[model samples]
Target: MPPAANRPRAVAIELNAVLVALIGDEPQVLTLENGALLPSGPFEGDHPTLQTGLRAWVERQTHHPLGYVEQLYTFADRSRAAATLGRRIVSISYLGLTRERAAAGEHEPGWQSWYRYFPWEDWRGGTPAVLSRQLLPRLRRWIDAAANAMTKRERRQRVEVNFADATWNEDLVLQRYELLYEAGLVPEAAARRPIADPLPGAPMHYDHRRILATGIARLRAKIKYRPVVFELMPPDFTLGQLQLAVEALAGRPLHKQNFRRLIDQQGLVEETGAVSAETGGRPARLYRFRREIVIERAVAGSKLPLSRSS
Candidate 1:
């Protein structure tokens, strides 16, 4: 180990925001750098707190206000330090949920579908072709390249669980991303290696993609035990619209009948005595989320019924 004085010192704190929204039937995230980066800035003493700083940066960069903000995770790996200065960089990430809005200014950051960054994670129609055709083979080679039997076996087990063919787990977003990173199949990993071809997906600057993965995994798990999905919903929406939003975030198709049953049982919404003519079907009743349920109950789980094929 190097002497204490010779060690790299913490030089900056960065606040990154993973702002998510459901637009049409796609789950979108606000991105900068032509959809290759999250909105982030250096934390300065002028802000009263970390969250305030994050809010200020996001608003200034994207020209949109944030809602339902929560701290995601902090990253301080040595490799995440400034490459040229050899100074440590601590990144504090946050997850923010909001309705989609047009960019306020000409140069504001725009929204891009999150699936563009994790193509294999989307299963709305069926299993994404990228999984078996691209990812699995590459992962198998990675597993076999392990030096020892024990290491190979452990890698295989992780791959099996995280990328299982028969069952898809929505909450494994971070695990899948990390596996790809470890296998050098992502651009971030390739940046550290001599590899040429990397898996398809828009890459972010620094570890912003990893932080987005963490936010995605957290949201997927959170919707199961809390009604936070309402934050992305409009004041009045048809059941079909609600299901589409859930499916978009979960990255899978949901059984319509079962989904409505779950929502009805939870009493999360009430009929608004209005109908939406734009549903592209027979007029569907509009419903508003019952905000009181959030206060009345300790836990209001949004039990999404996933299609087995997903």
Candidate 2:
């Protein structure tokens, strides 16, 4: 084949948005004042690297210097261009972790629960009844209505992927949204016309809903293998608080006994002999994350032997 015909084309990268705010234990995600999302425009000029560009874009928009950041994923649906005034836009998404700072120079910003955008993701209390009561029914109907066998198979695959009950895999957050988008059940896709109303969970403008999923999925998966949870927590907290934070991230209740055992065995915390007056039921001792764990034993990575049997 001729070089021109065989050449791989480069995607015309455009500026996209970065969604941020402090949700749970740490400064989590921030919402845009417009009730849209907290995303930054893409690079209008050259930058040293993608991380640098993302950081600069966020600082410019929110005046919050991001601390820990990693690429989330890229969203470039063909439909994004259908209603636009120009070319197909591809948003290179990123997740940045930072504590909320004073608006650097008087740029008022909005702060909202990251979960407000995806209520279903908050499993702290338990697997949201809506998942089984509402979403699953609709999803199953969508799965059954698949016109052909291949489409049906695809739907099943996605369901198994996101709602892995045999074992709740925390990493499929974004994949779930993408699958829903593909099925046209989500608002952003063209096929979404049939389901005009939002599902039980909260919604965001345009592709922002899916973006929120991306963040949730990333954070959930990260907690298992990283101490990123501390980034959202106070320097000192009780084991109960830690469990609550993890549960919040996981969007489900955990076995409290098992959770405490896991934390104590892991040596992830150091007792301060300080009672948290903020806790009501009983005075709880406060502790701080062993600062060295991030370097020692590689944070030992968080893990809870969670079971649905409550």
Candidate 3:
């Protein structure tokens, strides 16, 4: 057996949740601390499991019940140690999907748009002006300030590939946020440098923003191979409504015809023999997700083809 001095010490565990919902085509996340942080609390010794502890705290903090919850990631970075006052703290985070619900009373934390903390991630209309007008130039300066030519080149390459000049990859949410943090262009990175403007997006307390990024990236990737997005939708929806919800989450414009074709090919949804008069142009057919696919299929994919610029 090893000596007592060589044994590793135990660390405190924490539970954080990135609960997501969509309101009128805008993707939002439940937040606490006056929208400055995600709902989180330390894991108590009496709690039977990590998930139960998480659910308890989330319900207590937000007064909202979670649905379709899944583990997002565990973070134990050295920077996070400050929050525990030199003790090691491990944050186990979860991603949850649900429809927007009204608060029972006025005192709740309430849902805030996710884009408030990630403005550059959204591209449903087109590239966010903040990217070209502010972020890209700052990123270029950051790359140029690298210690060596090779480092500069590598940084530039990563930026290009992740941002994809004319075309954007919605799945790179976490990568983009980390790049900004390293460059000290975000408010959260102000401790590293004297930030001037600090970009447009709001900053969260501690590493909550980074955790949120992880959830966003995970959801973007999962939607391509799973029908999880249905958790955020109503019982009956039109093809246009479904496409809008996807575009809102993906932060890009999707080709309408291609999107409908992909959904039809997968047979993931079925018409309800109803039409929605809410649609402006004409009454559109309503459809409901086919839950049986969960048992019958091995894996299903939701293909979202991007719309080309005119």
Candidate 4:
């Protein structure tokens, strides 16, 4: 038998919350009172399954039932928290999708703009002015400070990929933040001193911002191959709302004519004979996602052509 000291110890189960809601044209995440993230509590030997536990946790806190739920990942990093003394606590993270309901006037889950946590991710107005104005210069200085040739090359590669002259790759959003963390460039890594004046985006209590980046990256990639974009849409929507959802995920505007053409060609949606007056012109027709395609293809996805201007 293996020595007792080498054997793995049983850890209490911990659940992490990743509550996302759409605001205007972007997602806002929920946070708690403590500096610690607003993740769910321990399984507490109460849950029969992870999903059941998640549903309960969300409803009890937000009073809004979750519409779509998916397990994100498990985290148990030693540096994550000072909990459990020296023991590493395993945290199961989940990506929960739901439309926000008005607060019942009681339980307060503070809503913060998701963009505040990820300023660089927004490009709906063409690369946030902040990136070109602030982040890039600091990043360049960090790049230039690399001591060796190989390190410099890696830094430049990160720069090129994260904030490249090439079209922004929506899928690499999380990877970009992680790369920054690893390079000791982000606020999370600069634990001891003030690195720069204000970071282009807001920082979270703990690793919540990083977790948000993970969700953004996952959704960006998922939308390309999984038809999950429908989760954020109304039961009926105008093509403009559809485009906005896609642009929100892609972080860039799509060509209007081409987007309509592609949606028509793919037959991913059907007109519902309903009209929305929200756009301030002739009422736009409403469309519903083709549920059949979602079931038949299961993982099928529609494409949104992205360019720098798109």
Q: Could you say which candidate leads in TM-score? A: 1
Residue lDDT tens for model 1, 1-310: 9997788675789999999998877889999888888999999899999999999999887778998899999998878737457567889999999986854467877788999999999888777899989889999999999999999999999999999878678899999999899889998886678668888888887898899999999999888888888899999999998888888888888887889899989888999999999978899999999998687564655666788542
Worst 10 residues of 3 by lDDT: 301-310
Cα shift from native, residue 305, model 1 (Å): 1.7
Model 4: lDDT equals: 0.74
Reference-based TM-score, model 3: 0.93
* Candidate 3 per-residue C-alpha lDDT over 23-62 given as tens digits, one digit per residue, 9 for 90 to 100: 9888999988778989999999888988889989998988
How far residue 265's Cα lies from its native spot in candidate 4, in Å, is 2.1
Top-down TM-score ranking: 1, 3, 4, 2
TM-score of each: 0.94, 0.80, 0.93, 0.88
Shift in Å, residue 122, candidate 1 = 0.2
In the range 1-310, model 4's lDDT, one tens digit per residue, is: 7786676655666777777766676766666663236657767567799878877886776566787889888877767654445455777778877666447354566766667777788888876877788777877888888999899998898788777746578788788788767656577876745565656566666577777787777777777777777887778888998888888767777888888888887778999988889899998989999978767564534666776665
Q: Which stretches of candidate 1 lie over 4 Å from their true place?
A: 1-8, 81-83
What are the RMSDs of all candidates, in order?
2.2, 4.2, 2.7, 3.0
lDDT of 2 by residue, 1-310 (tens): 6585465444555444444444445324665655566555666657887777877777777666777777888878766542354455677878766645545334566666666555555555566676677667778888999999999998887787786556556567777667666666655665446666546555566677777777777777777877877766777888888877776667667788888888888877889888888887888999998868567445454665666642
Q: Order of all candidates by lDDT, from best down to worst?
A: 1, 3, 4, 2
Candidate 4 has which clashing residue pairs, if any?
Answer: 17-39, 253-310
Candidate with best lDDT = 1
